[model samples]
Target: MMEAVKRFVGPKWRQYLAASLASYGSLCTGMSMGWTSPIFPQLRGPNSPLAEEPTLQQESWIGSLLVLGGLAGPIITVPLSRYIGRRWLVMGSNLPLLLGWLLAGVASDLPTLYVARLMWGCATGMQFATVPLYIGEIAEDHNRGALSSLFLLFINVGFLLAYAIGPFTSYWGLTACGGILSLFYVPFTWFIPETPFFLVYKDRNTEASDVLKKLRGTSKEAVQAELEGLQALVAREFKEEPKISDLWATRGNVKALGICVFLAMLLQLSGIDVLLFYMEELLVKVGTKISASDGTIIMGAVQVVTSCITPLVVDRLGRKLLMWTTSLGLTIFLGLIGVYALLDSYYNYDMGSWAFLPLLCLIIYMILFTLGVGPVPWILVAEMFPVKTKCLASGIASFMCWLAGFIWTRFFRDVAASYGIYTAFWVLAVCCGVGFVFSATLLPETKGKTFDEIQDMLNNRSKEPKPVAV
Candidate 1:
């Protein structure tokens, strides 16, 4: 059995294990995001535990607070990862998540619930900022996309778990499950090795070499050659640690930062966050005859299945192709949903028989979304920057993502109420259209490229640079 396990992990057991552990953190993030969907409906019901059921305004606060809390994660985790190492920092992130889940399980007041979600948001930020950096450093170039895309796949799994289980359990029971899920990440983290990049950065070359040997399952001679190449690449590429200002100062840095930030914003603007947060509410508002819980479950299932397809083909099809496809698909579906909402709202159209259309559109949107926008941003963020600038740049990009989520989610209900839900969908559709143009014009292909090669490609150095010998 041990031999079987070892054979399965192959030459890259360390990388695979590290990614698996970090992905569990993403799973917790998904659970936190998906929690609102099932719990919101329950809180509004007559049998609610609260003395007074939350008003719609309060509900928005409840949903948006997670993003608001998320804003702190990049600020804290990015720098902290520098000092403590990525492995421990990620392991430590689970503490806040577990506490948040436990608090949610027993909370009797709105304030308590708010605090719990805020902590979960902090964990979300940590995962987003740290995992990509870790995964980028550890994986082999050939399978990097397949490994990194696991981040989104696991997130969707967490979402599906919440949607499938939350409705059947008490609030306490659901949260207990989340807290239990957080615990699983700890044991996994123990066996996973730190990235050789970080070890080398810290002047621990021997340790870095050993880690490389373990990760590659290679002989010492091969590991030494691979390590030397990495050392040479790092020496040539970076002279000093990157600062926040560096994100804009250098031409290459600026281009990379801009792409990361824009992609992050586009992900939120695609309406996935809002959909996950208020899937039930949106279904009710759309007057869909499909039960909200059932619709939410189906959406979660579709997201998981579609997300699985990306890891299989991302390396084969290339990043640019998927981004273009997702952008076009999102634009069409979001626009269709807007038109449906417009007709329903203004034309006094009864959508009873055609009720399934909105749900179908959203499911299709989720499918397209998982294929690219959902996973590619993190992959690109990890790929584009020099190692020196990776953590800070990724943090900035992540912060922008959470900031966009905060703004969109906080006011989504108010916007829908004041301007009509159709207007909100229209705005998202416009964002998707812009995304299509951006993907076509600015996005670079990173398929099957080494980290240094990607940086060179981004800088317009060469399209066919000789492969870095390993």
Candidate 2:
């Protein structure tokens, strides 16, 4: 077993371990997102864990509070990362994550649940702001997409866990499981050192050179060359560390931030979060042939399977192509779902065999979603910004991403409740069509490109002769 593992892991395993450990926070976030999928029914039904059953409005709050708290976390992460560094921040995040789960595990009332979910969201948002920036610094251009896309892979596994396990586990039992998972991040962190870019930026060149050697598994000369490149980039970019205002300083920065913000909005407006959080409820309404619980589990399993394929193909396929094609694909698939929702909900039609249409539509929807907008936008956020404004820009973009999620998930239930779910589905389908147009017209291909190249492309300066990133 050890021989086989060594054969697979090879010498550059430190970078992978570092990226995966940092992304452990995403697993906790996924559990929080997926928790509502199976548990929503129980929360509002006879199996209620709270003192009283939650109404639809209350349930929306229950679902959106974590997202609402997402808005708060990025605000904290930007400044905190300056002092603690990405590795430490990623490690310490487990405290709040574990606390959130413990609160859920013992909660007896609605307010406690709200606070717990919000804490979960805050912890997730912090990771979102830090992990990608950390990964981008550590990974080589050749495999950056594959490594960064692990963010989605791990989170989707968390999604699968909740959907698969939530149905059978008691309410508190599931929370306990999540809290246990949160503790693993610390041990993972112990195995990996701080990112070489971060160490260089902090003026610890000796340590940075040593760490880079370990992460790159290269010889002294090669490591020294790599270290020098990072030193120049860090010296130039960090002469004065970037502020939120600095993101708007250069046209490249402005364009990069805009593109990232737009993509972030596009990702959430696709309404993937609504499905993750309300899969059981949505299927129950769709009247699928399979039980909603079964459908939710299958959908989640599909996410994990499909997500695994993304990291393999993302670097090969290129970012813009996958994003453009999948955006259109989502537009088509989501429209099909809207049609079934229209027939079933708006017309009050009852059919025998056609009941499988929504289920089929959603299955394909998850496929396209997981392949493209679901994961690619986050990668783009990590790629587009330069090191100078990376933390600030990333925090801004993540804030927009979660703010959009909160808006979409908060009102989706109410929209479905008010005008029938068909109305909500149709709206998302239209927005996805817009996303398709955006990707084709504006989204730059980040495949095999460095951050400087990406920023230049965003600013229409890629063709001009210039030095590589300092």
Best by lDDT: 1
RMSD of each: 3.8, 3.3
Clashing pairs in 2: none
Query: Candidate 2 lDDT, tens digit per residue, 46-138?
Result: 767787888899999988988888887789878888887878877767777887898898888998999999898888887777777778888
Candidate 1 positional error at 276, Å: 0.7
lDDT of each: 0.83, 0.82
TM-score of every candidate relative to the true structure: 0.91, 0.93
Which sections of candidate 2 miss by over 4 Å? 218-221, 448-456, 461-470
Worst 10-residue lDDT window for candidate 1 reads 233-242
Backbone clashes in model 1: 0
Model 1 scores a C-alpha lDDT of: 0.83
